[model samples]
Target chain A: MTRAALLLLADGRFPAGGHAHSGGAEAAVRAGLITDAASLEEFCRGRLHTSGLVAASLAAAAALGVDPGDLDAAADARTPSPALRAAARRLGRQLLRAARATWPCAGLDLLARRFPKGAHQPVVLGAVAQAAGLEPLDAAYCAAYESVGGPATATVRLLGLDPFDATGVLARLAPATDRVADRAVRAAREALDTGVDALPAASAPLLEISAEVHAARTGRLFAT
Target chain B: MHLHHPHDGHGHGAPAPSGAAARRPDGTRRALRLGLGGPVGSGKTATVAALCRELRSELSLAVVTNDIYTREDAEFLLREAVLPPERITAVETGACPHTAIRDDISANLEAVEDLEDAVGPLDLVLLESGGDNLTATFSRGLVDAQIFVIDVAGGDDIPRKGGPGVTTADLLVVNKTDLAPYVGSDLDRMAADAKAQRGHLPVVFQSLREEAGVDRVAAWVRERLAAWRA
Candidate 1:
């Protein structure tokens, strides 16, 4: 079941519309913030801490049976970049389509019907996980892994880095995923304990600015 | 607007629907998703425009263009009036165009979906990759089939470079055939090299500048669409 869930989430064909985005790696790369594998590692680490934190939290909430609409709104509020926000909505819509096709949870259908305007990826991922029978921690880990791991893998090809070296980067990231997942689980537990109405809210601003600037650029490699 | 629900842990008690359930019924009307990828200035955008002109009348169509910095490809198609303004969507890849089409693919998928949702049904959706060097290819997850465009002007020897895009694209289009004589490109040699590299796959020598060069490509697309339906 875990393998099936992973296959559904990691297939790259799940219709989440992730193909057009490179997270914030493209912007950071253009800003000269990330070049070599070491720099890429640093950037990924930061992402895991900031944006990844938010995504994991949301995923955890969804896995714990939080309403998809609430998670979507929370994710939207947390994301700052208009471009990234737009990209997130794009991804969310695709995820919705895929989720509806693969696992038509009533909650997911409700979320899609209620707010078709602008849902984010983490929110949709959370909803899909809840519908897919995954635990909150599992969903949190999936979100964090996808949010960071996909870009790290893409970096290998984009920068022409050795595949072994790229795998090494991912290996180093495994522990970090555990840490993020632990935090997310704790947060989800806390939210549940306090009643889902008391879920914590957080946002990242610098990343949003970077996304906006990245979207405005003329020569780049990733979409966001 | 808070719509909070308690952490019931029972949401999964009921079986969730599968991803295929979300697709439109009759699925036959679903457009074929085709990806166009190649190195910079290989005429991917030109090829897309040409395909639209050649097939739009016979088939309902839409285009999704990936550009690293701007919406140039979509704009070019719009300016050329290849398809309706609403049918063209541009994804600013912000980084390597290949990453979006080959690595992540979410944004492109969303654009395609939006086009489908808005247009009801389309016969084909063209995903034009941002310009990149050889070795770039579409993720099979993102495209049903893909065409790799390489211009003779870039050098006829590019086919022998043996990159994944050149060797793996379902159809390899050696574009800008008109520039062959001027650039000293040997069309026959390039064709032979590509044929050798791709085995049974097809290759087309095209010059979008010509009146009907895109006809062969359009025919190929029709064949694929028919096969997809069959």
Candidate 2:
């Protein structure tokens, strides 16, 4: 697997529509749940082990040639909020465009044709990793890191928190990110034998509920 | 680390077959995308409303408005009855309006593509950037052409300052010309400064409150469409 390809996918500037989203950090900040760097780390940790792990596993499974349709359904069942579900599909469509242009693979095109609107972002990310010639573990790392990285960057913007402290938060969480990715890849491999049910079902109800509330409100900065 | 890869012909080393103006997934040419960017209250949305009013009957057109906090711009277009609700879409910029249009255009691109898919075979797609600083400009990957709108009430010296949007836009529109005299702006000086800053690029001095309002800008858009088709 090409390590550089993994970096390219993981990069915040990949143009996959993550910038407009705060990964629920905007709502968290608004709720006073993530007020400072320390709180931000706490929030990221909770997210990394929950939604982050599930997203990473889905992406890893997609990289491992699992059926994206089934994985997308799995993602839907795991996500309780309709607002977050719509956001995922929207981001997924955007990523599909960028991935198709970046990877130029027939598999990506077929997925695009299949889910013209979008499948789910993690599902698409895993497929994108596959097209980019990366392994399942590489996809996991990309997904796991993004789950925290997106919020950290958004928190920097939302709270006007020190950018350096935000970077430090990410650095400190690097080891945890690795662990989540490892667990995610293991779950993905197990899914191949049993079923998608073998994958992790970790959940962060607050994030989901906050996303719904954020979507319902007006004058919010981030989309979700 | 190999910073480059075999697909380097495209973005991130993969040949990109499509972008702002590229063909749709079905191999049909996409709509002509024009961006309108300017400072706050400089009449960007007003200009979009006028253009839709002037051109909607003649050409298949849609609009995507990047609003920072709310759907005000999109809602205004819808309330104005300029276009049907479906044709007018709002993309939240997450308080960074410039980034959405210039830096990472993913959300805006998705809005545009979705518009085309839903009410498509469109001839033109107008993107209005949210009110931002003078330096904001649309990325080439986002728009085929761009118009920078500034009002005479804002300042005549704006042209002389010459930020990227004012200097490099395909068309520099000096809006609210009727208010120019009221605001004590020098029309001649603003025109001369625009010429100096833009060299040979076209500039339009207009007032939407006047007779045949938006005619000049509408004509310019028609010329652009003609060129796009040719």
Candidate 3:
């Protein structure tokens, strides 16, 4: 049941406007920072390690009943780039809206109200997932799926890769997703035990730079 | 460590204000959310500038701009002094402008909410989609009404191209009509094509360089706002 919920949340067709974004893949691709599938895989792996880690940690905290506002602030601090901070908040707000419509909960609604301006996407997702009774591990999976799967799916459209090949790539990355989820679950347990305030900061400067460049270009396929 | 204490106390003592509760009791002075979307350099920023100039006196306005990489559009509006800097919110879409406005709409919605929070009871919120392709259209879920902007410079036959945006926007604005003579675009043909494409929806031929082109668009928005209230 949790797996199904994670799939639903992570699905590219969930209409959260994720299709228009490549999560900095477009800029990296254009700058030759990422070339071919190998580089793309490496990029995804790195993202999984950095931004993905932050998202998963936040999601896990939310699953553990952490306040969404606190999670949002943590996300904001973790993201050093103004551009990325904006994007994360944007995605978070949208995801929260959809989550509210699909699964209403007091905790989620309260979180939505806390960041009237905007909240980070992962934080919101975590809060909503917790409200919906998803386990921390499941929440972590959903976060990783979105952070990684979104870019991978976008790659298909941007690179014009065969759908079969894309599916193959996703299949190969399935184990990595599991590994990442395990780490996130462990991290969340540690955070919950030590208090979410004790979590360490993780920021990727290169990704931040790439996102800023992606934002400036007049011609581009994705939003961020 | 000390910074965390106050926040924790606040979180525990009181529930954060909900979005629904943030609304003014009267709610009569709600803002109309307008979405602008089209290809890059299609003069979306120019149109926004023109609208702010035309409508600022009559309406309480705010703007939410989705730029792919920078706050350039918001900065442009700021430089033009269209509205107070606080009234304008920028969402660095980071990837595709369309996603922020259409697919996800969270960032844009939050920006709208933020503007409302900062400047209560705005008459309208203009959301400028980052320059995008012909396929881009604002989600009805995001904006009360949307304008699909295409310049005559893009091509006269663009209306005939039959993209979702051209056919379905609340208002189809054929901007840069002044450039028509230079670009070899026949205004009449483009108008007719747009009309054919949109059976009943209104289409306006505008040259922002003209004295009152934006006013007409603003008037159309006013009508929509009136209808929304009614």
Best by TM-score: 2
Residue range B121-170, candidate 2, lDDT tens digits: 99999999999989999988788899999999998899999999999999
* Tens digit of per-residue lDDT, candidate 1, span A107-186: 77677666565477777787778778777877888888877876776676577767787677778988998998889878
Candidate 2, residue A141: the lDDT equals: 96
Report the CA-based lDDT of candidate 1 relative to the real structure.
Answer: 0.75
Model 2 earns a TM-score of 0.94
What DockQ would candidate 3 receive versus the native complex? Answer: 0.24
Give stretches of model 1 more than 4 Å off.
Answer: A1-50, A95-118, A131-133, A144-180, A193-197, B1-28, B92-106, B132-145, B158-171, B191-202, B222-230
> What's the lDDT for all of these models?
0.75, 0.89, 0.75
Q: Quote each prediction's TM-score.
A: 0.74, 0.94, 0.78
- The weakest ten consecutive residues by lDDT in model 1 chain A span A195-204
Candidate 1: docking tier: acceptable
True contacts kept of 3: 0.25
Candidates 2 and 3 compared by TM-score, better number: 2
